[model samples]
Target: MKKQLLVAVSLCAGFIASAMADSRVTIHYPGQSQALVLQGAANLEQLTLRPELNGRTWWPGTVIAERTASGIQQQTQQQTQQQLLARLSAFSAALRGDNDGELAGSVDRVRTQLAAMRVTGRQFVPLDPDWIRLHAEANRRLSGEYSVYTLSRPTSVQVVGVTTPAGPQPYQPGRDVAEYLQTHQRLSGAEKNVVWVIQPDGKTEKVPVAYWNHRHVEVAPGSIIYVGFSSWSLPRAYRDVNEQIVSLLTHRIPD
Candidate 1:
Protein backbone atom coordinates (compact mmCIF):
# COMPACT_ATOMS: atom_id res chain seq x y z
CA MET A 1 0.00 0.00 0.00
CA LYS A 2 2.80 2.43 0.93
CA LYS A 3 4.62 1.71 -2.37
CA GLN A 4 1.43 2.30 -4.38
CA LEU A 5 0.79 5.66 -2.68
CA LEU A 6 4.35 6.83 -3.41
CA VAL A 7 4.01 5.81 -7.06
CA ALA A 8 0.73 7.75 -7.45
CA VAL A 9 2.28 10.90 -5.88
CA SER A 10 5.28 10.73 -8.25
CA LEU A 11 3.06 10.43 -11.30
CA CYS A 12 0.96 13.46 -10.27
CA ALA A 13 4.09 15.58 -9.77
CA GLY A 14 5.43 14.60 -13.19
CA PHE A 15 2.13 15.52 -14.83
CA ILE A 16 2.12 18.93 -13.23
CA ALA A 17 5.70 19.60 -14.32
CA SER A 18 4.95 18.70 -17.89
CA ALA A 19 1.85 20.86 -17.90
CA MET A 20 3.88 23.90 -16.77
CA ALA A 21 6.65 23.65 -19.34
CA ASP A 22 7.42 26.85 -21.26
CA SER A 23 7.06 27.28 -25.02
CA ARG A 24 9.84 27.85 -27.55
CA VAL A 25 11.10 31.38 -28.32
CA THR A 26 13.20 32.61 -31.23
CA ILE A 27 15.37 35.72 -30.96
CA HIS A 28 16.58 37.55 -34.06
CA TYR A 29 19.42 40.01 -33.79
CA PRO A 30 20.40 42.62 -36.31
CA GLY A 31 23.03 41.53 -38.87
CA GLN A 32 23.23 38.01 -37.41
CA SER A 33 23.06 35.14 -39.86
CA GLN A 34 21.52 32.75 -37.31
CA ALA A 35 18.68 33.03 -34.76
CA LEU A 36 18.81 31.75 -31.17
CA VAL A 37 16.13 29.26 -30.20
CA LEU A 38 15.28 28.87 -26.54
CA GLN A 39 12.95 26.69 -24.51
CA GLY A 40 12.21 26.34 -20.77
CA ALA A 41 12.30 30.08 -20.13
CA ALA A 42 9.51 30.60 -17.57
CA ASN A 43 8.91 34.20 -18.63
CA LEU A 44 10.41 37.36 -20.12
CA GLU A 45 12.78 37.76 -17.13
CA GLN A 46 14.35 34.35 -17.67
CA LEU A 47 14.51 34.85 -21.43
CA THR A 48 16.41 38.11 -21.03
CA LEU A 49 19.22 36.45 -19.07
CA ARG A 50 20.29 34.16 -21.91
CA PRO A 51 23.95 34.65 -22.83
CA GLU A 52 23.05 34.97 -26.51
CA LEU A 53 21.40 38.36 -25.90
CA ASN A 54 24.33 39.77 -23.92
CA GLY A 55 25.83 43.13 -24.97
CA ARG A 56 23.23 43.66 -27.70
CA THR A 57 21.45 46.96 -28.07
CA TRP A 58 17.74 46.85 -27.24
CA TRP A 59 15.91 49.27 -29.47
CA PRO A 60 13.04 51.14 -27.83
CA GLY A 61 10.86 50.19 -30.77
CA THR A 62 11.78 46.49 -30.55
CA VAL A 63 8.91 44.29 -31.67
CA ILE A 64 7.81 41.02 -30.03
CA ALA A 65 5.09 38.87 -31.56
CA GLU A 66 3.57 35.68 -30.17
CA ARG A 67 2.56 33.06 -32.71
CA THR A 68 -0.57 32.05 -30.79
CA ALA A 69 -2.07 35.53 -31.18
CA SER A 70 -1.24 35.91 -34.89
CA GLY A 71 -4.60 34.72 -36.15
CA ILE A 72 -6.63 37.08 -34.00
CA GLN A 73 -4.27 39.96 -34.77
CA GLN A 74 -4.63 39.33 -38.48
CA GLN A 75 -8.39 39.38 -38.25
CA THR A 76 -8.35 42.65 -36.34
CA GLN A 77 -6.01 44.22 -38.92
CA GLN A 78 -8.21 43.09 -41.78
CA GLN A 79 -11.31 44.60 -40.18
CA THR A 80 -9.52 47.89 -39.63
CA GLN A 81 -8.15 47.87 -43.18
CA GLN A 82 -11.57 47.20 -44.65
CA GLN A 83 -13.10 50.00 -42.62
CA LEU A 84 -10.39 52.43 -43.71
CA LEU A 85 -10.84 51.40 -47.33
CA ALA A 86 -14.59 52.00 -47.09
CA ARG A 87 -14.03 55.40 -45.55
CA LEU A 88 -11.52 56.38 -48.23
CA SER A 89 -13.96 55.26 -50.92
CA ALA A 90 -16.67 57.42 -49.39
CA PHE A 91 -14.26 60.38 -49.30
CA SER A 92 -13.47 59.84 -52.99
CA ALA A 93 -17.18 59.68 -53.88
CA ALA A 94 -17.98 62.84 -51.94
CA LEU A 95 -15.06 64.70 -53.55
CA ARG A 96 -16.06 63.56 -57.05
CA GLY A 97 -18.93 66.09 -57.16
CA ASP A 98 -16.83 68.85 -55.57
CA ASN A 99 -14.73 71.36 -57.48
CA ASP A 100 -11.37 70.40 -55.89
CA GLY A 101 -9.68 68.06 -58.35
CA GLU A 102 -6.34 68.27 -56.51
CA LEU A 103 -7.90 67.06 -53.27
CA ALA A 104 -9.64 64.19 -55.04
CA GLY A 105 -6.37 63.14 -56.66
CA SER A 106 -4.57 63.23 -53.30
CA VAL A 107 -7.20 61.02 -51.68
CA ASP A 108 -6.99 58.57 -54.59
CA ARG A 109 -3.22 58.35 -54.26
CA VAL A 110 -3.44 57.53 -50.53
CA ARG A 111 -6.15 54.94 -51.15
CA THR A 112 -3.98 53.23 -53.76
CA GLN A 113 -0.95 53.10 -51.51
CA LEU A 114 -2.93 51.72 -48.57
CA ALA A 115 -4.52 49.00 -50.69
CA ALA A 116 -1.11 47.82 -51.93
CA MET A 117 0.54 47.55 -48.50
CA ARG A 118 0.78 44.04 -47.06
CA VAL A 119 -0.92 43.13 -43.80
CA THR A 120 0.99 40.73 -41.56
CA GLY A 121 -0.87 39.12 -38.65
CA ARG A 122 1.93 40.02 -36.27
CA GLN A 123 0.84 42.04 -33.20
CA PHE A 124 3.44 44.05 -31.33
CA VAL A 125 3.89 43.77 -27.57
CA PRO A 126 6.04 46.07 -25.46
CA LEU A 127 7.87 43.15 -23.75
CA ASP A 128 11.00 45.11 -22.89
CA PRO A 129 13.30 42.73 -20.99
CA ASP A 130 14.73 45.50 -18.85
CA TRP A 131 11.25 46.50 -17.70
CA ILE A 132 10.03 42.92 -17.43
CA ARG A 133 12.81 42.03 -14.99
CA LEU A 134 11.51 44.56 -12.47
CA HIS A 135 7.80 43.97 -12.93
CA ALA A 136 5.43 41.75 -10.94
CA GLU A 137 4.43 39.75 -14.02
CA ALA A 138 8.01 38.56 -14.49
CA ASN A 139 7.19 35.07 -13.25
CA ARG A 140 4.33 34.47 -15.68
CA ARG A 141 5.15 31.71 -18.14
CA LEU A 142 5.71 32.69 -21.75
CA SER A 143 3.84 30.59 -24.27
CA GLY A 144 3.92 30.07 -28.03
CA GLU A 145 6.62 31.31 -30.37
CA TYR A 146 8.28 34.70 -29.85
CA SER A 147 10.38 36.73 -32.28
CA VAL A 148 12.64 39.35 -30.69
CA TYR A 149 13.80 41.75 -33.38
CA THR A 150 16.71 44.10 -32.67
CA LEU A 151 16.43 46.39 -35.66
CA SER A 152 18.99 48.94 -36.79
CA ARG A 153 18.25 52.64 -36.28
CA PRO A 154 16.32 54.09 -39.19
CA THR A 155 17.82 56.97 -41.21
CA SER A 156 14.75 58.33 -42.97
CA VAL A 157 11.21 59.53 -42.20
CA GLN A 158 8.15 58.99 -44.39
CA VAL A 159 6.06 62.03 -45.32
CA VAL A 160 2.56 61.21 -46.56
CA GLY A 161 -1.04 62.42 -47.03
CA VAL A 162 -2.37 65.43 -48.96
CA THR A 163 1.09 66.56 -49.95
CA THR A 164 3.23 66.58 -53.08
CA PRO A 165 6.75 65.13 -52.80
CA ALA A 166 5.25 62.62 -50.37
CA GLY A 167 7.22 59.50 -49.39
CA PRO A 168 10.52 58.98 -47.60
CA GLN A 169 12.82 61.93 -47.06
CA PRO A 170 16.33 61.89 -45.56
CA TYR A 171 16.10 62.34 -41.79
CA GLN A 172 17.79 65.50 -40.56
CA PRO A 173 18.65 65.87 -36.90
CA GLY A 174 17.32 68.95 -35.04
CA ARG A 175 14.93 69.83 -37.86
CA ASP A 176 11.53 71.05 -36.70
CA VAL A 177 8.22 69.68 -38.07
CA ALA A 178 7.47 72.86 -40.05
CA GLU A 179 10.81 72.70 -41.89
CA TYR A 180 9.98 69.27 -43.30
CA LEU A 181 6.64 70.61 -44.60
CA GLN A 182 8.46 73.40 -46.41
CA THR A 183 10.10 70.83 -48.68
CA HIS A 184 6.71 69.37 -49.63
CA GLN A 185 3.73 71.18 -51.14
CA ARG A 186 0.53 70.71 -49.13
CA LEU A 187 -2.57 70.10 -51.27
CA SER A 188 -5.58 72.47 -51.08
CA GLY A 189 -7.42 70.30 -48.54
CA ALA A 190 -4.46 69.51 -46.30
CA GLU A 191 -4.39 70.90 -42.77
CA LYS A 192 -2.30 74.03 -42.57
CA ASN A 193 -1.89 74.39 -38.77
CA VAL A 194 -1.04 70.85 -37.68
CA VAL A 195 0.18 67.41 -38.70
CA TRP A 196 0.18 64.01 -37.04
CA VAL A 197 3.55 62.42 -36.30
CA ILE A 198 3.48 58.68 -35.81
CA GLN A 199 6.65 57.52 -34.08
CA PRO A 200 8.34 54.16 -34.55
CA ASP A 201 7.11 52.91 -31.18
CA GLY A 202 3.43 53.45 -32.08
CA LYS A 203 3.11 56.76 -30.31
CA THR A 204 1.24 59.59 -32.03
CA GLU A 205 1.65 63.33 -31.57
CA LYS A 206 -0.26 66.33 -32.92
CA VAL A 207 2.28 68.89 -34.03
CA PRO A 208 1.60 72.52 -34.92
CA VAL A 209 3.34 73.48 -38.18
CA ALA A 210 1.61 76.70 -39.27
CA TYR A 211 3.49 79.92 -38.56
CA TRP A 212 1.06 81.46 -36.05
CA ASN A 213 0.59 78.30 -33.96
CA HIS A 214 3.93 76.73 -34.84
CA ARG A 215 5.51 74.70 -32.09
CA HIS A 216 9.00 73.28 -32.57
CA VAL A 217 8.21 69.54 -32.67
CA GLU A 218 11.15 67.43 -33.82
CA VAL A 219 10.44 64.58 -36.20
CA ALA A 220 12.06 61.23 -35.40
CA PRO A 221 13.72 58.87 -37.81
CA GLY A 222 11.47 56.12 -39.18
CA SER A 223 8.47 58.25 -38.18
CA ILE A 224 5.60 59.14 -40.52
CA ILE A 225 4.61 62.76 -40.97
CA TYR A 226 0.92 62.68 -41.90
CA VAL A 227 -0.49 65.93 -43.24
CA GLY A 228 -4.16 65.29 -42.67
CA PHE A 229 -7.19 66.54 -44.62
CA SER A 230 -8.68 69.73 -43.25
CA SER A 231 -11.63 69.06 -40.92
CA TRP A 232 -14.00 71.33 -42.84
CA SER A 233 -13.47 69.32 -46.03
CA LEU A 234 -14.43 65.96 -44.46
CA PRO A 235 -18.07 64.99 -43.89
CA ARG A 236 -19.22 64.46 -40.29
CA ALA A 237 -19.03 60.69 -40.60
CA TYR A 238 -15.45 60.77 -41.93
CA ARG A 239 -14.05 63.41 -39.59
CA ASP A 240 -12.12 60.73 -37.69
CA VAL A 241 -10.54 59.23 -40.80
CA ASN A 242 -7.20 60.90 -40.19
CA GLU A 243 -7.03 59.52 -36.66
CA GLN A 244 -7.84 56.05 -37.97
CA ILE A 245 -5.09 56.37 -40.55
CA VAL A 246 -2.62 57.28 -37.81
CA SER A 247 -3.65 54.22 -35.80
CA LEU A 248 -3.11 51.92 -38.77
CA LEU A 249 0.24 53.48 -39.53
CA THR A 250 1.31 52.88 -35.93
CA HIS A 251 0.77 49.12 -36.19
CA ARG A 252 2.62 48.79 -39.49
CA ILE A 253 5.40 46.17 -39.40
CA PRO A 254 8.87 47.60 -39.56
CA ASP A 255 10.69 47.25 -42.87
Candidate 2:
Protein backbone atom coordinates (compact mmCIF):
# COMPACT_ATOMS: atom_id res chain seq x y z
CA MET A 1 0.00 0.00 0.00
CA LYS A 2 2.89 2.40 0.85
CA LYS A 3 4.53 1.72 -2.57
CA GLN A 4 1.23 2.52 -4.35
CA LEU A 5 0.94 5.85 -2.41
CA LEU A 6 4.50 6.86 -3.41
CA VAL A 7 3.75 6.30 -7.10
CA ALA A 8 0.58 8.44 -6.90
CA VAL A 9 2.41 11.32 -5.13
CA SER A 10 5.19 11.27 -7.76
CA LEU A 11 2.64 11.39 -10.57
CA CYS A 12 0.93 14.42 -8.98
CA ALA A 13 4.27 16.24 -8.64
CA GLY A 14 5.15 15.54 -12.26
CA PHE A 15 1.80 16.96 -13.42
CA ILE A 16 2.33 20.09 -11.33
CA ALA A 17 5.81 20.62 -12.72
CA SER A 18 4.61 20.27 -16.30
CA ALA A 19 1.76 22.71 -15.70
CA MET A 20 4.12 25.33 -14.22
CA ALA A 21 6.71 25.19 -17.00
CA ASP A 22 7.23 28.38 -19.04
CA SER A 23 6.16 28.42 -22.68
CA ARG A 24 8.68 28.47 -25.52
CA VAL A 25 9.65 31.77 -27.13
CA THR A 26 11.22 32.20 -30.56
CA ILE A 27 13.60 35.10 -31.22
CA HIS A 28 14.04 36.15 -34.84
CA TYR A 29 16.89 38.46 -35.81
CA PRO A 30 17.24 40.24 -39.11
CA GLY A 31 19.39 38.42 -41.74
CA GLN A 32 19.42 35.29 -39.59
CA SER A 33 18.37 32.10 -41.34
CA GLN A 34 17.40 30.28 -38.14
CA ALA A 35 15.51 31.56 -35.12
CA LEU A 36 16.73 31.23 -31.53
CA VAL A 37 14.46 29.24 -29.25
CA LEU A 38 14.38 30.05 -25.55
CA GLN A 39 12.59 28.29 -22.76
CA GLY A 40 12.18 29.41 -19.12
CA ALA A 41 12.40 33.15 -19.86
CA ALA A 42 10.18 34.61 -17.10
CA ASN A 43 9.62 38.09 -18.50
CA LEU A 44 10.70 40.74 -21.03
CA GLU A 45 13.68 41.74 -18.90
CA GLN A 46 15.04 38.22 -18.84
CA LEU A 47 14.45 37.68 -22.58
CA THR A 48 16.18 40.92 -23.59
CA LEU A 49 19.30 39.94 -21.68
CA ARG A 50 19.87 36.79 -23.71
CA PRO A 51 23.34 36.57 -25.27
CA GLU A 52 21.90 36.40 -28.78
CA LEU A 53 20.56 39.98 -28.48
CA ASN A 54 23.95 41.41 -27.54
CA GLY A 55 25.93 43.64 -29.96
CA ARG A 56 22.89 44.17 -32.20
CA THR A 57 21.59 47.55 -33.29
CA TRP A 58 18.12 47.15 -31.84
CA TRP A 59 15.30 48.77 -33.72
CA PRO A 60 13.01 50.55 -31.22
CA GLY A 61 9.98 49.22 -33.08
CA THR A 62 10.69 45.57 -32.25
CA VAL A 63 7.52 43.47 -32.40
CA ILE A 64 6.38 40.73 -30.00
CA ALA A 65 3.78 38.38 -31.38
CA GLU A 66 1.88 36.54 -28.64
CA ARG A 67 0.02 33.49 -29.92
CA THR A 68 -2.85 33.76 -27.41
CA ALA A 69 -3.80 37.28 -28.51
CA SER A 70 -3.46 36.75 -32.27
CA GLY A 71 -7.04 35.76 -32.94
CA ILE A 72 -8.52 38.77 -31.15
CA GLN A 73 -6.08 41.14 -32.83
CA GLN A 74 -6.91 39.77 -36.28
CA GLN A 75 -10.64 40.18 -35.69
CA THR A 76 -10.21 43.76 -34.49
CA GLN A 77 -8.11 44.63 -37.54
CA GLN A 78 -10.59 43.14 -40.00
CA GLN A 79 -13.46 45.02 -38.39
CA THR A 80 -11.56 48.30 -38.60
CA GLN A 81 -10.79 47.63 -42.28
CA GLN A 82 -14.42 47.01 -43.09
CA GLN A 83 -15.50 50.20 -41.34
CA LEU A 84 -12.88 52.28 -43.17
CA LEU A 85 -13.84 50.85 -46.55
CA ALA A 86 -17.49 51.61 -45.93
CA ARG A 87 -16.72 55.19 -44.96
CA LEU A 88 -14.48 55.69 -47.99
CA SER A 89 -17.25 54.44 -50.29
CA ALA A 90 -19.65 56.86 -48.71
CA PHE A 91 -17.19 59.73 -49.11
CA SER A 92 -16.77 58.92 -52.80
CA ALA A 93 -20.53 58.83 -53.27
CA ALA A 94 -20.84 62.27 -51.68
CA LEU A 95 -18.28 63.63 -54.14
CA ARG A 96 -20.48 62.44 -57.03
CA GLY A 97 -17.37 61.17 -58.87
CA ASP A 98 -15.80 64.64 -58.83
CA ASN A 99 -12.06 65.60 -58.54
CA ASP A 100 -11.38 63.25 -61.45
CA GLY A 101 -11.70 60.35 -58.94
CA GLU A 102 -8.17 61.05 -57.68
CA LEU A 103 -9.16 61.11 -53.98
CA ALA A 104 -10.99 57.78 -54.19
CA GLY A 105 -8.16 56.17 -56.16
CA SER A 106 -5.45 57.22 -53.73
CA VAL A 107 -7.40 56.05 -50.69
CA ASP A 108 -8.14 52.74 -52.41
CA ARG A 109 -4.43 52.18 -53.01
CA VAL A 110 -3.65 52.85 -49.33
CA ARG A 111 -6.36 50.42 -48.25
CA THR A 112 -5.05 47.78 -50.64
CA GLN A 113 -1.57 48.03 -49.20
CA LEU A 114 -2.94 47.81 -45.68
CA ALA A 115 -5.10 44.81 -46.60
CA ALA A 116 -2.13 42.89 -47.94
CA MET A 117 -0.43 43.10 -44.54
CA ARG A 118 -0.76 40.18 -42.15
CA VAL A 119 -2.51 41.03 -38.89
CA THR A 120 -0.99 39.50 -35.77
CA GLY A 121 -0.92 40.10 -32.05
CA ARG A 122 2.09 42.36 -32.59
CA GLN A 123 2.90 44.59 -29.65
CA PHE A 124 5.26 47.50 -30.45
CA VAL A 125 7.00 47.56 -27.11
CA PRO A 126 10.41 49.16 -26.70
CA LEU A 127 12.95 46.39 -26.09
CA ASP A 128 15.44 48.62 -24.29
CA PRO A 129 16.22 47.03 -20.93
CA ASP A 130 16.25 50.40 -19.22
CA TRP A 131 12.84 51.32 -20.56
CA ILE A 132 11.40 47.97 -19.60
CA ARG A 133 12.77 48.21 -16.06
CA LEU A 134 11.10 51.58 -15.50
CA HIS A 135 7.70 50.63 -16.84
CA ALA A 136 6.05 47.86 -14.88
CA GLU A 137 3.67 47.00 -17.71
CA ALA A 138 6.57 46.54 -20.10
CA ASN A 139 8.29 44.17 -17.69
CA ARG A 140 5.29 41.87 -17.29
CA ARG A 141 5.75 38.13 -17.20
CA LEU A 142 5.74 36.37 -20.55
CA SER A 143 3.90 33.20 -21.50
CA GLY A 144 2.61 31.33 -24.55
CA GLU A 145 4.41 31.13 -27.90
CA TYR A 146 5.96 34.57 -28.25
CA SER A 147 7.92 35.64 -31.31
CA VAL A 148 10.43 38.43 -30.71
CA TYR A 149 11.49 40.11 -33.95
CA THR A 150 14.63 42.22 -33.93
CA LEU A 151 14.42 44.14 -37.19
CA SER A 152 17.14 46.04 -39.02
CA ARG A 153 17.11 49.81 -39.44
CA PRO A 154 15.05 50.98 -42.39
CA THR A 155 16.41 53.45 -44.97
CA SER A 156 13.21 54.91 -46.47
CA VAL A 157 10.04 56.54 -45.22
CA GLN A 158 6.70 55.55 -46.68
CA VAL A 159 4.49 58.42 -47.93
CA VAL A 160 0.92 57.31 -48.37
CA GLY A 161 -2.69 58.57 -48.22
CA VAL A 162 -4.00 61.08 -50.76
CA THR A 163 -0.76 61.03 -52.76
CA THR A 164 -0.18 59.97 -56.32
CA PRO A 165 1.58 56.58 -56.52
CA ALA A 166 1.68 56.29 -52.75
CA GLY A 167 4.76 54.34 -51.59
CA PRO A 168 8.21 54.68 -50.07
CA GLN A 169 10.44 57.70 -50.68
CA PRO A 170 14.15 58.02 -49.91
CA TYR A 171 14.69 59.20 -46.36
CA GLN A 172 17.02 62.19 -46.19
CA PRO A 173 18.62 62.91 -42.86
CA GLY A 174 17.69 66.19 -41.11
CA ARG A 175 15.05 66.90 -43.79
CA ASP A 176 11.95 68.76 -42.61
CA VAL A 177 8.59 67.00 -42.87
CA ALA A 178 7.40 69.71 -45.26
CA GLU A 179 10.25 68.90 -47.68
CA TYR A 180 9.18 65.26 -47.83
CA LEU A 181 5.58 66.33 -48.56
CA GLN A 182 6.77 68.62 -51.36
CA THR A 183 8.40 65.65 -53.12
CA HIS A 184 5.10 63.73 -53.12
CA GLN A 185 2.33 65.47 -55.05
CA ARG A 186 -0.82 65.59 -52.96
CA LEU A 187 -3.89 64.22 -54.71
CA SER A 188 -7.15 66.13 -54.93
CA GLY A 189 -8.99 66.47 -51.58
CA ALA A 190 -5.73 65.99 -49.67
CA GLU A 191 -5.16 67.99 -46.49
CA LYS A 192 -2.92 70.93 -47.34
CA ASN A 193 -2.14 72.52 -43.99
CA VAL A 194 -1.38 69.52 -41.77
CA VAL A 195 0.05 66.04 -42.37
CA TRP A 196 0.20 63.09 -39.97
CA VAL A 197 3.57 61.50 -39.18
CA ILE A 198 3.53 57.90 -37.96
CA GLN A 199 6.94 57.09 -36.53
CA PRO A 200 8.38 53.59 -36.38
CA ASP A 201 7.82 53.43 -32.62
CA GLY A 202 4.05 53.51 -33.18
CA LYS A 203 3.69 57.15 -32.21
CA THR A 204 1.61 59.55 -34.35
CA GLU A 205 1.96 63.31 -34.67
CA LYS A 206 0.11 65.97 -36.63
CA VAL A 207 2.57 68.27 -38.39
CA PRO A 208 1.79 71.57 -40.07
CA VAL A 209 3.14 71.88 -43.62
CA ALA A 210 1.44 75.00 -44.94
CA TYR A 211 3.47 78.16 -45.49
CA TRP A 212 1.67 80.01 -42.74
CA ASN A 213 1.84 77.34 -40.03
CA HIS A 214 4.76 75.28 -41.24
CA ARG A 215 6.86 73.83 -38.40
CA HIS A 216 10.24 72.23 -38.90
CA VAL A 217 9.34 68.73 -37.76
CA GLU A 218 12.12 66.35 -38.71
CA VAL A 219 11.00 63.24 -40.53
CA ALA A 220 12.60 60.09 -39.18
CA PRO A 221 13.74 57.22 -41.33
CA GLY A 222 11.29 54.31 -41.47
CA SER A 223 8.43 56.68 -40.62
CA ILE A 224 5.22 57.15 -42.59
CA ILE A 225 3.96 60.55 -43.75
CA TYR A 226 0.20 60.37 -44.26
CA VAL A 227 -1.49 63.22 -46.12
CA GLY A 228 -5.07 62.44 -45.31
CA PHE A 229 -8.32 63.84 -46.76
CA SER A 230 -9.14 67.44 -45.95
CA SER A 231 -11.35 67.73 -42.89
CA TRP A 232 -13.69 70.13 -44.64
CA SER A 233 -14.19 67.66 -47.47
CA LEU A 234 -15.30 64.78 -45.23
CA PRO A 235 -19.00 64.18 -44.58
CA ARG A 236 -20.31 64.88 -41.08
CA ALA A 237 -20.78 61.19 -40.33
CA TYR A 238 -17.26 60.29 -41.46
CA ARG A 239 -15.39 63.26 -40.05
CA ASP A 240 -13.05 61.06 -38.01
CA VAL A 241 -11.96 58.88 -40.91
CA ASN A 242 -8.50 60.39 -41.09
CA GLU A 243 -7.85 59.74 -37.39
CA GLN A 244 -9.02 56.15 -37.82
CA ILE A 245 -6.67 55.67 -40.76
CA VAL A 246 -3.75 56.88 -38.69
CA SER A 247 -4.63 54.47 -35.89
CA LEU A 248 -4.81 51.53 -38.30
CA LEU A 249 -1.48 52.45 -39.87
CA THR A 250 0.15 52.22 -36.45
CA HIS A 251 -0.55 48.49 -36.40
CA ARG A 252 1.13 47.82 -39.74
CA ILE A 253 4.02 45.32 -39.70
CA PRO A 254 7.37 46.79 -40.67
CA ASP A 255 8.96 45.46 -43.83
Which candidate achieves the best TM-score against the true structure?
A: 2
Task: Tell me the whole-model lDDT of each prediction, alpha carbons only.
Answer: 0.75, 0.76
Pairs with backbone N, CA or C atoms under 3 Å apart (clashes), candidate 2: none
Model 1 Cα displacement at 211 (Å)? 0.7
lDDT (tens digit, per residue) of candidate 1 on 62-96: 55556655556556776888889888987887787
After superposition, which runs of candidate 2 have C-alpha atoms over 4 Å from their true positions? 1-21, 28-37, 52-57, 93-100, 133-137
lDDT of 2 by residue, 139-235 (tens): 8677666777676778888888887767888888999889887767877778999999999878899999999999999977889898888976676
RMSD of each candidate relative to the true structure: 3.7, 4.0
What's the lDDT of the predicted structure labeled candidate 2? 0.76
List ranges where model 1 is wrong by over 4 Å. 1-21, 24-40, 48-58, 67-70, 98-100, 119-125, 134-141, 145-150
lDDT over C-alpha atoms for residue 109 of model 1: 79
Taking all chains together, each candidate's TM-score versus the true structure is 0.78, 0.79
